[model samples]
Target: MSLSVVICCYTAARRVQLIRGVQSALEQAGDRDEILVVVDHNDALLADLRDSLPHQITLITNEFQRGLSGARNTGVARSRGDVVVFVDDDAVLATGALDGARAAFEDPTVVAIGGAVRAEWAVGSGPSWFPEEFGWVIGCDYRGLPACGERIRNPIGAAMAARRQALVEIEGFSTELGRVGDLLAGCEETLMGVQLQSRFPGQRIIRHTDFRVDHHVPADRATLRYFTRRCYQEGRSKAVLTRISGRQAALSSERSYTTSVLPSGAWRARRNPRRLLALVIGFGYTTAGYVTGLLLSTRSAAAA
Candidate 1:
């Protein structure tokens, strides 16, 4: 299947990482594949990319709302590939990642595919106090994911691919729930996965460990404050998603992660007080955010 790799950027701060990500896609893209760089309402960044990025990449400013989801929707609208793959501006695709996505789509039963995302921390490695269970807070694949390729509820947004038809069928990612500027809200991809499965029953969203991307984790995200804030934001995003898609669809994976994965992780980290404490704190922050978000959503519904 032809793949269209979409790399979206919003700031000049990640100019180097964005360039590297585009170059990586250019290198690994197949003959039938195409690369698109969507700049989310950043005129200066768009101009810079136009001058520096290779001519092979199709560059365009986001024509939709001002967030990752809208930028992605813009890319999908302009793309011509069978599979639309999303690569974060701060991430580099591993060799053969696109190939793996193409191979997986060979099975008509699969509608979406996500790969492993390894962290490339700015200070060499994550802080010693950071627990692996909360890696999602930093936008990297965490410890709770299945060890091998399998059908999954959803794919991480940092590096995931979906059938263009399925995306079109679902009308693309929602503008309601995703990062708007520096806001930590997310779960646009999760909602998309639920919509895809619901619209096309029996189709699969597979997680392929072999197809991977190295996501850059900036130093700012390595702090304790950022960790707690992100966890809380994640909970808020989940609550918003649950309101839109219903709890069962929005939180099936979270149920397993909270009940089985987290408890297991906490138990395994018993010997390491720091790690255990981090996990506990992260869970608490997330839970608090979810509760607050739920109340807000309920109030909004009543007001409506």
Candidate 2:
């Protein structure tokens, strides 16, 4: 099966790293695979991409809205491959990654394949208090995730592949539940995962630990402030996901993380003063965000 790898880009500051990510996709892809770069309506950034190290790479503007979900929809609409893989603009794929995705599709029962994502830290290492259990803060696979191949509810957006026809059947990502420019809110992937299973009852969402990519984590993201903010945004996004997808299933994993994982991480941090302090502060921040998100969602519903 042919593969179409789509990378959505926005800022020019990521120019060098974004090109590296593109190169990684090219290297990992088989001869039948194609790469598409979808710029999120940043004209100057789009123009600069055209000028610098000019290649025949297919580039397009987001046709629908100006957001992550919109750009992804734009690329999927134009992609030619049977399976379309969404790779983060800052992530670099591992060797033979596309081949793995292509192989998963051979089963026919697998609608989507999620690859493992490891963090490539710009600062060499993360803070002592920032637990690995919360790796989702950096968009990396966390400690509690399945360590081997298994059926999953959703693949994190970093490097997930799906059948083109499947995406079309479910009508692509929801326009309401994803990042729009500066807004960090998102759940489009989570919402789509729900639709994917609903649309095809027998098909499964698979996560293969070996099919991998290194998602770049900038130095700024390693900070406690960023960690807190991300968890808060995650809480807000979770609320949105609950609204779109049923709350019971939408929060299954989250419940596990909150009750079992976070508490365990907190207990583990008690030995270190820095870690303990961070745990207390981060927990409070996330709780506040969750409450605020729920309140706003309720208000919005009432107004509607």
Among all candidates shown, the one with the greatest TM-score: 1
Clashing pairs in 1: none
Candidate with maximal lDDT: 1
Q: Taking the tens digit of each residue's C-alpha lDDT, what string does model 2 give over 225-276?
A: 7888877887788777777777886787778877988788878878887877
Candidate 2 residue runs with Cα over 4 Å from true position: none
What's the TM-score of every candidate structure?
Answer: 0.98, 0.95
lDDT assessment of candidate 1: 0.91
